[model samples]
Target: METAPVPAFSELISGTQRSAVHLEMRDVYDPGSRRFASWRSGHRENPANRDEWWNPFHSVIAEAVARGVQVRRARVVSEPVSDYVQFEYDVTFSNIAAGEQVRWLPRRRASDLALPGNDFWVFDGRLVRLSHFGGNGEFVQDEMTENPAVVKLCVEAFERVWERAVDHHDYRPA
Candidate 1:
């Protein structure tokens, strides 16, 4: 059976590229239940939406590790404020199937990228990639997507921050 086509953005360069994409987003509080609920209700604010957005990406990483897809991640463990705790991950794909892992990420301003802020969005098209603004309006979102070169630079930045980051066990399952 045929599947639906992936959406593209002006900032995002759509093509079959053997490249690494860097992504940053606000982590949903109750991703498991909330994520799935949002998907069912069409309510981005709902808890299930968080899970819907993350599980697939998590799976992608897991799969890459399993199948040897050449992927890795770097993240910022903490920020000055709770809301500022920015976590970034870089997934490099050695295998580009179906044009660069069809994906999407919602954008937020650098200042507004904080805790209880909820201004981040990310998704691998094959997985879940949507999020809601968790009621904080401190940050105004300026979003865009580019090609491999720009993405590589972002990945480098994520690596720098990741080096100083603390391991986050908050979201890890028991």
Candidate 2:
């Protein structure tokens, strides 16, 4: 399948009728983001303060969920997680607050799974957008694929991780 430029997540997620599942396999993502700076400075926002923490991304998620889309995300992280992963952990409350089902799995537990090479969101079990990133954790590109083989692999990988992962509320950043 030919790849397309990154489409708006709201559009992609909204087009789904049943589910949109994301699998994040990186320990670090965009290590240079300003959000991480705030976290490092001991300035993590309180999740309960919706006025302070809610953003467009959250709005998109909320809308999708309101329309009955099942939005789920699973992360495979290292034990004694990297600072970047911890930063992700800190901000994850917004994801949950926005109606996402988030979970975390230590990498050691994923050794037997056949995961894809990149992070991806599989929407409705029919399409996938593979998120590519650099070694420094910066965004590179997003490739959208409707290939049945690839979609099957992604759904299988996400379900495998989801089955093994701890719910975000119960997961303490290792």
Candidate 3:
């Protein structure tokens, strides 16, 4: 009897032999300056406004790439390259093949900014896990994944939004 492969997020980032790591950061806009209060309406009510809060999306990415993660940035709507979905999977798979790390940030329209479904784990570029974040910085929903069909659906939604977005690097926080 053949055994079904257990899907793992780290496996995708670490490549086959563990020599390189590839990562893709897909977001509707640059998150460096996006305040939690604005992103999360709940936060707006309490209004703590820490002020110095930094989005881990960028900093963690910088650290990983600086530590040798091959990072790629793309939008879902990018032309001359209509295969944003394929591009994302390829990036994830290739990075995993190189033993590198990959991260994805897909924006969803929801009331809470910290919502987890905004993120995903793709192995070597293939979808592995689907997760959602809630209002309190917690995983609101988590599904054990690695099903290709499921991954395609998620990636498709990401591409749709990516196509309409401007590049992540175009913005600079004032």
Q: Give lDDT tens digits, candidate 3, residues 1-174.
A: 122444444443344221222222332222222343243333222213323333334444445555565544332222222233333332233333323333333323222222223455443445445445554444455344546665565555445444444443342111
Instruction: Give me the runs in candidate 3 sitting further than 4 Å from their true place.
Output: 1-11, 16-118, 140-142, 172-174
Native RMSD of candidate 2 (Å): 1.1
Which window of 10 residues has the lowest lDDT sum in candidate 3? 16-25
Is 1 or 3 the stronger prediction by lDDT?
3
> Residue 16 in model 1: shift from native, Å?
9.8
lDDT of 2: 0.91
CA lDDT of each prediction against the hidden true structure: 0.32, 0.91, 0.38
* TM-scores, all models, native as reference: 0.33, 0.96, 0.37
Cα RMSDs of all predictions? Answer: 12.0, 1.1, 12.3
Q: How close is candidate 3 to the true structure, as a TM-score?
A: 0.37
Per-candidate clashes, comma-separated:
19, 0, 26
Global local distance difference test of model 1: 0.32
- List the candidate 1 regions with Cα displacement exceeding 4 Å: 1-57, 77-149, 168-174
Query: Model 1, range 47-99, lDDT digits (tens) per residue?
Result: 23434344444544444445433333333232232322221111122122212
Best by lDDT: 2
Clashing pairs in 2: none
Local error of candidate 2 at residue 48 (angstroms): 2.3
